[model samples]
Target: MSNEQVVNLNTKNKKINNRQLVKLSIFFTSVIAIMLIFLTNVYIVKEGEYKVVRQFGEVVRIDDQPGLKVKIPFIQSTTTLPKVKMTYDVTEEEINTKDKKRIIIDNYSVWQITDPKLMITNVRSVTGAESKMEEYIYSVVRSELGSLEYKEIVNDEKSSRGSLNEQVTLKVNELLQKNSIGITVLDVRMKRTDLPSENEQAVYTRMISERESKAQEYLSKGDASKNRIIAETDREVTELLAQAKADASVIRAEGEAEAASIYNQSFSKDPNFYSLYRTLESYKKTINDETVIMIPSTSSFAKYLQGNN
Candidate 1:
């Protein structure tokens, strides 16, 4: 081959290489465009999610069924909201009871999205739905529990534990039905309802004072009963003593009368001998070994002594 022939061959090879570079660039651009289109238009709706497609800030449709999805490229955008039940723990709020007692209440709610389009129209997202539901929840809780006494709603072994929480949930659901947010509250529960720290001591003090008053009343009643029993016992004892004394006096009088009658009968038999016997008995009773004789010799005992002759 001549040098000119070699030059022509080299030029052909260079042209061929440029053509191949253009073809490669076009192929790579097409691949990048296809990838971009797929990313913007194609999406997957997972098992527990609802994909909301919006066109120009307006919700066009909701892809609720779990599968692959497609949309118009460059004009459609998507977001997902959970289709399963959700829970929101509301912050603790201070409330008042029907008795004007201040209490703190902490509660939670279970909810779900029933209408995806309505949710997007009003709530727009799960967070907005929760906020709207919580608003109704607060209203219902305050009204329902506030209609009851402080002790009525409190949980205790003695309390009947009524359906206030359930009623509140029902009312919230009822109220939420008017709003088109499409969230249905399954339940609302109060985890705790307690007196504020500042009011607890005061309430406890009042309770203690009431209890003490009742105790004092009982003590008063018991004391009155004890006094009544003592008075009755004293009356019975006095009556028994009086009756015993009267019987003893009657018995003593009868014995004295009988002794007089016996003495009269015996003296009627021997009057002079009775006089001598009485004198001797009197002398024996009145005289002792220490007695001194100061009587004249003419005494009645002097004759009895002379009889010794």
Candidate 2:
């Protein structure tokens, strides 16, 4: 071959190799870009989350399943909402009841996102749901409380309060359903139902006074009962003692009468011995160490002392 032809061939081969290298570099770059887009577009739906897929600010789909998921790259976005139970603490506010008394109510709610599609359509965002829930719950609580007396709300006795928490739960659920908040209200509880700060101390004092009054009443009743028991016991003892005294008198009289009858019968049988016994008893009665007797053949005690009769 000629020198010029050989040079042209070498130049053509170099251009072909350059084109192949450029194409190879472009192919690899395109693959890397596609892989990056796929990686970036992927998202995970955790066990307790529901993801809402939005395309250009509009909700297009909902991913309820938990695992890896992919969406349109750079065009769609995903927002995850908690599917587990959540709680919202409602703010404390003064509410009027049927009795025309104002009270402060602090409440909380347990809820969960049940339907992702409905949540997106109605609430749009979790924060939006929370705000809407707060409004709805406040309205429900106000309305329900407005129909009850302040005494019912603040009763310390649970039975006397008459299922207040259940009423609140039912009312809140109804209101949430009406507003389409797409949340299931598991429970609604009252943290506190109390009088305002300015009135609380007065109410407490009144309660204390009432409790003390009741205690005093019980004490008085106990004392009265004790007195009645003591009086009855004293009456029984007096009656028993009087009966015993009467019985003793009757028994002594009967014994003395029987003894007199027996002695009369014995003395009538032996007159001389009865006289001797009477004389001896008289002498025994008349003689003692303090006795002063005039002698001169009179007193038996003088005869015995003088050893003559």
Task: Please report the candidate that would top TM-score against the real structure.
Answer: 2
Candidate 2 yields a Cα-based lDDT of: 0.83
Residue pairs clashing in model 1 are none
lDDT of each: 0.87, 0.83
lDDT of 2 by residue, 218-257 (tens): 9999999999999999999999999999999999999999
> What local lDDT score does residue 251 receive in model 2, on the 0 to 100 scale?
99
Q: Any idea how many clashes model 1 has?
A: 0
- C-alpha RMSD by candidate, in order: 7.8, 3.7
- Summarize candidate 1's per-residue lDDT along 24-131 as a digit string, tens digits: 999999999999999779999999888989999898998989888999988999988888988899878888889988899899988999898987788767888888
Task: Give all TM-scores, in the order shown.
Answer: 0.67, 0.80
